[model samples]
Target chain A: MTIKRKILAAILALALPLASPVLASEQAVTFVQNNVSKVLQVLSDPALGDVQKGKLFSEVITQVTDVDVIARFVLGQYAATASTPEFERFARVFRGYALGVYQSELSRFGNEVLEVQSVQERKPGDSVVLTRISGGALSKKSRDVKWRVITIKGTPRVVDIEISGVWLSQHQRAEITGIITKNGGQISAATKMLCSQSKTCTVTG
Target chain B: MALAGCVHPPWRAKSDPLEPMNRAVFAFNTVADKTVLKPIAKTYQTITPKPARKGVRNFLDNLQSPVVFVNDVLQGKPKRAAKTLARFAINTTVGVGGILDVAKAAGIEKHYEDLGQTLAHHGVPSGPYLVLPLFGPSNVRDLAGLGTELAVSPLSFTRFKGKQTFGRVRLALNTMDRRVETLQEMKTIRKNTLDEYVSIRSYYQQLRKDAIADGVVDMDELPDFDLIE
Candidate 1:
């Protein structure tokens, strides 16, 4: 209620919104950086066998990725119509398939180091972090990778990724929805086909 | 859910009506790539220096510039057409017969325009996807465009000593360069995707869409990534 205190409060209020996005962007960068390092560590651990490395990789993927959001997005219009149980089954298979994908991709860069280059905040809690992977295994050239991270209820999670200009989730959406449409709009049929083909997921009913 | 108003999305319009035949061809191409082309490309990558490989790529791209320039004009992009011309002239001379992309160094960045994009610009529908043996994924419109380009290209008519041999060498180098460039990417796709055929189809369509639009992605087609729950 003093004049100086009132002015100080107004200044703080004005600066909070401006500062929050910067903080969120920084957090998003750190989130991706830490996860990338963890993945690299798991990959390079000589003591860990293939199965152990896979389990660790799956854990890291589950920890950092918003699998539910990705599942719904890739499922497209079918997500709106499917029963909760059916959608849950689809999401389960999708999560496994996605984990396999991330594992296969990350395993290829066994000895590379990922360094966060910059972050672009798209909205209040969403940011795109650009990183480069080079050195160690990648002897010839470095590769640029982009991670799309979003904060949900104070936790940052990765929603998508772009490698070599191809967005992985976007590509999946097109392919999965195409499969559903090809199967005459049968989500179950699409699920069965994807599960069978992936070999990484189990089909229930 | 009401079924009356539901319709397939536009991206879904890129259908593959010839799935069985396409899959057969795809299998053949995959085998050919694994057995023959991949080994040759890998060996080429191992033996050839990076700069030499880059020079070959630059030279191949330069050879296609005339065709790209024609397509740019056909697509009503005069600025791009001019750039193509400028790039050809600069690279052919200062870049040592297009072995180096001096034009790119001078800030005239490269942009690809093909007859397929020109037809798409003129509102021709991309018919059902077709997988060509050895050539990989293409649509009816793009396949036609390829034929047209081959017929109209000046290189097709140029006369020189050992012209037939030179043409074969060029084709071989182009194919090898493409395989070398995509070796890791192809492996990733094969290892990751649920269905290799479907994945390749989706990637090919999206890549063509981007090319037709001159690399400007349609934001509306992109998934919403801002889940704040």
Candidate 2:
């Protein structure tokens, strides 16, 4: 190949990949902007009614969500050892539990409006961290919830999220473990009890 | 980052419900996950979903059901009805692969109305809202819930149920999964730890009040300690 052609090829290759991350990041931004707005809508306009809001919370949020990711976090370090079966189970229970909790909280979503502070490339590759929201302090402090998007192999995935104010994973672990301990240290027994109370689980039958 | 330096009060009885020191510890604990953990969890949860996912949570919770029974006993709280419902629900869910849908379908919902909530229900007053380093947000009663419940967490079950450590895996996954779901919120909070902490605590306290009292609390009724005011 001619030198000119070779250089052109290289430029095209680099440009496309670089462009990919930007595109990917935009996709995530659009996802949250659109979907979160939907959540806010129900929150803001009480007249729209909760039946729709409940459906959105249960169906839409669940469909677009990555509960396995939350399950992984809820697991803390335990995800490493959890088998495929173990991982999957956590995802379901956690997803249902999360949905239940969120379904309860979405009523407040309208009251809280998050602003995007900044969106920047975290890595040279196709990953961008979009910083959103704030602590709303006297200085009008700005807090960030960073959404990470990158291609794993070839497919894009939202690999991580960082919220500045809390170490949610550990907090959850402590809470779950706390429940277990509070129950006389029977982790299985405690976990089962918690799940059974929820309509989302098979525990009731 | 400025919020990380304050000292944490002993686990109970602080002057302000949201103290700088307590905020500091709470902020410290939340920074990374609020920053990274939840997103990672979201990603993980998104990638995998099979049938087992349904039951794993229930199975693990069933294993932990005894704690409910014990906590009920400890608080000297009544609601033997709630206790029976919990036992039945736990039994069925654990019988299957941790799927609570069946139990829920049958009409038994999880109601962790331990002695603490009972006290709150009985007009013991929530006292002041406090945010513990690791304990997110709680009033004295819920804080006591954490303290009292910790006395019987499933960690000890790790001893006898070592054979069923599978439950531990479920516990961890549940934590990670839920964390990921809150990624967007946590990330926002991390950036403004103090403000976010205060807001979250305020909102949460109100939420609990709603959850326990009316089963549906409205935002308008809450103390609007405005973000600016």
Local distance difference test, per candidate?
0.84, 0.53
Which 10-residue span in candidate 1 chain A carries the lowest summed lDDT? Answer: A101-110
Q: Which ranges of candidate 1 are over 4 A from the true structure?
A: A1-23, A117-122, A197-202, B1-58, B65-130, B140-148, B209-221, B225-229
- Model 1: per-residue Cα lDDT over A1-205, one tens digit each: 6999999999999999999999999999989988878877888788999889888888877888889888888887777787888888888888878777777666667678898988887777778888999987788567788888889779999888877667788888877877787677777876786688675677787
TM-score for all models, in order of appearance: 0.74, 0.41
lDDT of 2 by residue, A98-135 (tens): 66554543443344446654455544323434445433
- Residue A104 miss distance in model 1 (angstroms): 1.1
TM-score attained by model 1 = 0.74
DockQ of 1: 0.22
Q: Give the range of the ten consecutive residues with the poorest summed lDDT in model 2 chain B.
A: B220-229
* Model 1 chain B worst lDDT window (10 residues): B4-13
CAPRI-style quality class for the chain A–B interface of candidate 2: incorrect
For candidate 1, what is the DockQ-based docking class?
Answer: incorrect
What lDDT score is found at residue A17 in candidate 2? 80
